[model samples]
Target: MFTGLSAFPLTPMNEQGVNEHEFIRLVECLAEAEVDSIGVLGSTGNYAYLSSEERARVAKLSVENAGNVPVVVGIGALRTRDVLANAENAQQAGAGGVLLAPVSYQKLTDDEVFSLYETVCRSLSVPLCVYDNPGTTHFHFSDELHGRIAQLPQVASIKIPPVQNDLAAAKARVAGLRALLPSDVTIGISGDPAAATGLLAGCDAWYSVIGGLYPEIALALTRAAQAGDTEQAIARSAALEPLWALYQEYGGSLRVAATIAELTGNVSQPCLPQPLRTLQGEARKRVEAVIDMLSLS
Candidate 1:
């Protein structure tokens, strides 16, 4: 199963489609940096925005170019059929695992959500992770729901979102999940700001966004936390506060990350959709300063 600091890369796109050549280069960079794994098409990868063909292409590109690193593809969709199709596509593309969130156009009942996963996973031979992202999906998974889903044959891991702005509460959430989930299942921390605390509190891995752009640092933090080295973990975690603060202020890490790639000359500026935009004017300068502060530039 995929674990540790799983870097979720931003899919570089051009007019025609996903920029295959440059995207592969980014994947190779993660491999060289020795990231524990690569998560393609995650929230940061804009899974909801891309076409099925684009997702399939990125999955193949990542798995092919990742060298020895495991590639986990995000396969969440509004419909069960679409999610199943995505799962099949990723599995066919040689993905290590697939991350699935219950994104929906309507509020889903607990039974509906549970059934959705049971149905989608029933057909897949590959292990799947339940992505309990309440913010995007708006479908909350209570502990009871989690227990029911744990019984599903293909459910191997649960990617739990950390409680925003409350690292201690986030730790408790992970602890609670550890208590409720099957012992064999791995618990990964996804919310960026709480990753260090969540890992220290006992989550097995970090499903990271910034780590996609800065794998070495993310790897350092994850390893330190895994090793129970509080000082190193705190140091690395503290270093990330500025950027994390921006994430909280701007309400997301997507735009901040996309802007960093542009400012650092990693790729041409990413084309984010409406209501979400890269940091601008003073906000842009502040982000650059934070990058310089962390020496990420």
Candidate 2:
């Protein structure tokens, strides 16, 4: 479940809450495309905004519609108690795995972060992926800390942030982490822009945002890298540079991804949660232009 393309689809929403039909369609789309896994309620899925009931329902819907594709549900929360509840909900919904980020209001120490994983791991019936998304969680994991948490039971994979653009440097960074982790624990790469680099550098998986929207293209790139076709993988990633630039310009992938979903009619006009608006005016136009130019459906 940790290996290959694990697409993180957005949890399309409406005034009535989660757009169940659209969410199911998105899951089925990924399943039809044969992605290695479907990650519902990730950052891209707006997991932070959804209530516990909504999250559990989303997990159930995703698992129900994902066909044979394994589903990994995000179980992040501010308090450990809430995190455990979320984890329980995911497990009850039949999630193949759970992704946990060290979400916090105040800064968390390494010990606190480690304890969080230890506490959660004890309760998780399914395997857990350590989500090292410092961008959102604000708690960065050192190699030492990652080693410590990875030693715990039920920890199957560690989703590291983007590595350096330089392939050699990326390889060294991945190798360093691999040496610390147990042989059974896989290393999955997030940060879409650096996916090719990370995969070509010997990472085991791509926890992708773009993959959720365009699974065929993303899967091609992932397969190329995993097959050791370095030139093809790099070229494929370069082709998506425009989209990656949009991610940088738009501040993050959430707005851009929501824009794509809307543009493609996969979701309603206002799919994001309140206070988090989709791309508008010229920004939306730019995204539309790129989508058309790139022939992205």
TM-score for all models, in order of appearance:
0.94, 0.99
- RMSD per prediction, one decimal? 1.8, 0.7
lDDT digits (tens) for residues 183-291 of candidate 1: 8788888878878888888788899998999998889999999899977887888888998898888778888888888799877655454445678899899889998
Error of 1 at 53 (Å): 1.0
Off by over 4 Å in 2: none
lDDT of 2 by residue, 1-297 (tens): 999999999999976799898889989999999999999899999999989999989999999999999999999999999999999999999999999999999999999999999999999889999999989988889999999999999999999999999999999999999999999999999999999999999999999999999999999999999999999999999999999999999888999999999998999979999989999999999999999989997
lDDT of each: 0.85, 0.95
lDDT of 1 at 97: 86
Error of 2 at 50 (Å): 0.9
Lowest lDDT 10-residue stretch of candidate 1: 268-277
